[model samples]
Target: MRIILIGFMGVGKTVVGKSLAKNLSIKFIDMDNEIEKRENKIISDIFKESGEEYFRKLENDLLKELVKQDNIIISTGGGIITKQENIDILKQERKVVFLDANVWTIQKNVSKEINKRPLLKQSENIAETIDNLLKKRINKYNDTYNIKIDINDKNINEVVSEILVHIG
Candidate 1:
């Protein structure tokens, strides 16, 4: 089985995806980490050097590659759905899960690691930025995921359990 987790940044997609993969005894792949590994640079550096358009193209290509494999859980970058190609790919998957979290939850979750995120670094006000981005992407997220899991105020295990129930 291939499980894909999608959401805005700081929504615990990576955390929940790892736990879900472990519970199901499958390999877990974080798309950002994979892209960094392949590019030989951190995502922020990729953004700085090559720009976001370059990074999104890489992301779309990687998503195409990853979807062909089996028994893996893919935790995608927050903005992966921004591309029409990516949304089309995600819509074809059976277990694409949208892990939804509110603006306050996202801000609190990502406060410590703001430097690691390229998009957040560009924001003058993180909360407002998050809100605006979420507003733009929420409809795409709704259209792409077959299942939606609310991650607000939930532990990783709780989220994983909820995902298991939905995917089982």
Candidate 2:
């Protein structure tokens, strides 16, 4: 069973995914980390050097390759659902869960560590960018996910339990 978690950055996909994978005894893979390893560059560096379009293409390709694996819990990049083809490919192979958290929750979690995210570099208008990006992709996220999980105010254990219930 391949379980894919998709959501905006700082929604705890990686943190929750790691816990869920350990509980389920499955391999955990973060797509962004995989891309960085493959390119031998950090994601921020890749976006800076090659442009977002190029980085997105790399992400799309990696997504395609990752769906072929078994018993894996994959945490996808926030913008992975921007492309319809990527959504289609993920749905074909695995059950996708959207980790639904409000924009404020996301902003609060990510604000201190904005530099880690290549997409949120500008300090002055970070909130605006996050809002715009979330707005633009929410429809795709809604359409693509098999299960929608609201993680606001929820602890990791609760989120993992919710996911396991949905999967069953």
lDDT per model vs. reference = 0.95, 0.90
Leading candidate by lDDT: 1
Model 2 agreement with the true structure over 1-168: per-residue lDDT tens digits: 999999999999999999999999999999999999999999999999999889889999888888888899999999898777898886675489999998888998898889988888865787788888889989989888888999999999999999999999
* Shift in Å, residue 25, candidate 2: 0.4
Give the local distance difference test score of model 2.
0.90
Model 2: number of backbone collisions: 0
Looking at candidate 2, the ten consecutive residues that score lowest on lDDT are 85-94
Collision pairs in model 2: none
lDDT of 1: 0.95
Top model by TM-score, which number? Answer: 1
Model 1 TM-score on a 0 to 1 scale = 0.98
- RMSD values for the candidates in order, in angstroms, are 0.7, 1.1
Deviation in Å, model 2, residue 8 alpha carbon: 0.8
